[model samples]
Target: MTTENRAGGAPAPAGAAASSAFRQPKAVWAVAFACVISFMGIGLVDPILPSLAGKLQASPSQVELLFTSYLVVTAVAMLVTGWVSSRIGAKHTLIAGLVLIVVFSATAGMSGGIGQIIGFRAGWGLGNALFIATSLAVIVGSASGGFAGAIVLYETALGVGIACGPLLGGLLGNVSWRGPFFGVSVLMLIALVATMILVEPTPRPEHRSSISEPIKALRHRNLSLTSVTGLLYNWGFFTILGYAPFLMDLSPLRLGAVFCGWGVLVAIFAIFGAPWLKARFGTARTLYGNMALMAVVSLVIGVFPDNRTAVIVATITSGIFIGNNNTLVTTAVMSIAPVPRPVASATYGFVRFIGGGLAPYAAGKLVEHYNAHVPFIIGAVTVAAAGVVLSTVHRALDAADQEQAHAGHSAQRADAEATA
Candidate 1:
């Protein structure tokens, strides 16, 4: 990919000036649609968490292993995605990922015990790691609306998937906890078929990426700092995502509705709110403020874990902060990292997902040993610390913004010359 494409620079010549983010080639839409289903896996189990615990005769910690197995495996598997995708190409990798998800999700649905489901989820995570990393790069490379637009499109898919996952889970889980699993299996099968048909085959990279490249890329100060901050932020993000349903004490359907509301806000802010905030406040200020606000929200959850209304309101409100952070942080990683976009994505995913994977299980354990308040309190501290870590990179953020502006201006000049 060109530097402009990788860094969210200028739009490609095909539709440089006229391309709206919403106007994309059929292939871009195909990957994006797959992204929606892939992301649904993150929250598809939320409404069913309580149900799973009871049905499987498992403790909260044992049930939380579903997330632990999936995410932790995903995090580790991120290391090899670039290696795998480079050799076989993006399209095959995506198909491989989708197939794993379909098979494992179906098996998970048939599982009679929590341990069996957790094992299957780990397999699902491996596929997720491959699909998630490659999809972002494919979208960025093929999208019409420039790098910024591509990121927005991707985040929109993420937000939509997250929002719909719980709603679908609740709607289906109302009948049986296994319904959501089968639902994912069926939806992904369709996505796999669509991908095979719509997305053009990608050529293998001239040079294969080594597994160590992502870890080596982390030696760069800006990328590592940004990734570490992400790790801290996710610790708080998943704590609520994983553990808060128990506190809500609502039925599966109602719990899904609550998270669906949260996911809606996540989508809205990521698409619309993030751009406005970044333009007005600048990326650093926007991220700092956003992270601090999320910290406050986590603290609120900590304070009133038992107050259903307070927990619900605070949980939903955190989505706004989460959405803004997701867009801005991802943009920052793409722009500031010195390595290739794929490498940066892999490194960032490797580090951040570890936190996301672990936080929920930790929260569950903390609740078992201490009280509900303790985990959220810890979550608040970590989020606040993320803001502090981010402050160290103000210069990097400014430089990235300036570089993107320069590229945008240059692209406009080129477009004018071509027209003339």
Candidate 2:
């Protein structure tokens, strides 16, 4: 947060030095600006799609691929970028991602053919993947006391970007469908400049491995299940984002309201719910509880798309799970790992992007073959399985924590005896 090493010796008391995220300063704002720029791209495109098609004289279906291509590109980027970041450090990755965003977003604005547009869109995804995976890593690393408060603020920033997308998209889309993305291009350029000049290079430990440590970290039980579940949950999560409009074709107003309203609820509750629910249920239980709700909502929505009221209710209910699931799983990953917070956070992010990318394509297939509803069933079932995996991972973490605590106490006693 301070972008300075408080660990060696700062004038602050031990507790103040420890609680840096609470007072993190300019570095926090710099990272937050990066988040807003990244999310604006992801969230803004939907509102402008119709206008984009009209400008290009493309069909409605063709415009849909913009969303698909973006997700797929971002997913692949996220998975590989982690390995790359682990090698170079988080700051380099963040700056590189911002550069990618600037380049691709500009190209997207200038795209001529359908293929050109898709290519540029895909490029933006790659940039986003980099921004996300590494920005998260840096935030955790710089989060003095650790991930606790840092994650809360990070998610809040994400939620704000997502919430503003439709409003920004609609306003800009009216000016020109291409206008919103060009707006994104401008935003990225700012972020690119800020990141290079403002974001402090994350200090890596001298003992940090060269190229493959993150891969080894991935094999840890807590990391593995958390990563896997993150993927499944996001897979289901993005499906709702991808297909809600189609499901609500009976009412245009309802569709718009549902998507926008969900964002509102998530922003309001993500930080607040963590304390109330997390303390009672614990991380694994809270994560599972959200997944269970996701499954139920998917089923209920899939079954009865006719009732607009039920659909909206389902929409808002699902929003409650969005940020808290993030908080729960991310916190769990750190708690489970002996390696350190940054390592676990980055690893969880990489695999989760894999899930986010693939889910849309898979859901498209299900919708093509069976019913429009089939994807929901498949995603739900998969997420439930992920919940089970997380539960098992939690048991492993509890056992490990007990062992570490015992070892620490034994060491303290031995030190006392030696001194006496």
Candidate 3:
């Protein structure tokens, strides 16, 4: 319920807090389990990109549209997730997302051509928008640990799901690319049941958010800056994620193994490395350094596209930095924004996802028109630009972090005095 900070805007060492931070009620774990599956959707199709291209008779650019269609729809629909959840309640919204994913994923598997599968993926994206928008709010509201702990739990699931997605896709793609789709359907169905049985229904908020509210939240300066930074970072992030698979020339299984290793690093860094680094370096410094490092990594991948081993190592290496960015940026968004959490989340999601959706599609075009290296070169430049953007907001970001620590410290003191 309360927290204290040491020097330089860091929370007091989490030693005393760590034990209880991870302990959660069964309901929390159930939602977390579902979250793992939900996030797996991000990378679930990665290992099958080549297979899909071959079987569907689609070009690399067409295959890349799979990412484009899904993420574009998801980004556009993010604006309404808060509005929809406020009316329907979180449980039903989550179930609706699950149902859509199941139906669309299965339909994608059965589709006759690339066009049909791409269309079906759009529908799946809408489901993802609803689920992802609400899942964080639900977990934060229900979890036993403090806000930091809940974030850790959520990021942990993200790391695991992302790590496992390629592995599952690889294994299933070995049988048939269709296998991954059916597998997600079955896994999500189980997650759906667990959510229904274990997670309690969330009551609607007192003042329901309007569709316009998330858009309005962007009027705040800090929120906009953070969102723009996210957009640029995402451009680089997805460039590698969306385009690199084609260059590997490995089997689906081998590709999965590489990303799986990447995912494991993502998990480890998000949980342990991020907090530790932020505590020592602070958010602004850490982000600047990390983004710069990512730029170099992306360039390495681009410069040596034909070097299988370098590309592979860089791919896995990028995960550590990506994991750090995911946690820190999410925290920064929550802290810096003055609007309600749901609205802030929706707004932030809307802005950043545009870059995420566009980058992969553009990467495909770049490869078609130019060389394989152009996308990564462009990705590196944009990522470096994001670090500069974040630097411009350094003062406000530091103030927000300090205020959060002060507020938490005051609460802890109040509790101590009352008990005494």
As a whole number from 0 to 100, the lDDT of residue 95 in candidate 1 is 92
**Error in Å for residue 15 of model 2:** 16
lDDT of 3 by residue, 323-400 (tens): 999988887887667676677778888888889889988998999999999999999999999999999889866775
Model 1: weakest 10-residue lDDT segment is 411-420
lDDT of each model, Cα atoms only?
0.88, 0.65, 0.82
Q: What is the lDDT of residue 316 in candidate 3?
A: 91
Q: Which ten residues in a row have the lowest lDDT in candidate 2?
A: 411-420
384 Cα displacement, candidate 1 (Å): 0.2
Tens-digit lDDT string for candidate 2 (55-113): 78865446656776787778655556656776677788888888888888888877787
| Shift in Å, residue 411, candidate 1 | 17
Q: Model 1 over residues 80-198: C-alpha lDDT tens digits?
A: 99999999999999999999999999999999889999999999999999999999989878886667778889999999999999999999999999999999999999999999999
All candidates: CA RMSD (Å)? 4.2, 5.9, 4.3
lDDT of 3 at 411: 24
What count of clashes does model 3 give? 0
In candidate 2 the C-alpha lDDT for residue 152 amounts to: 63
Q: What clash pairs does model 2 have?
A: none
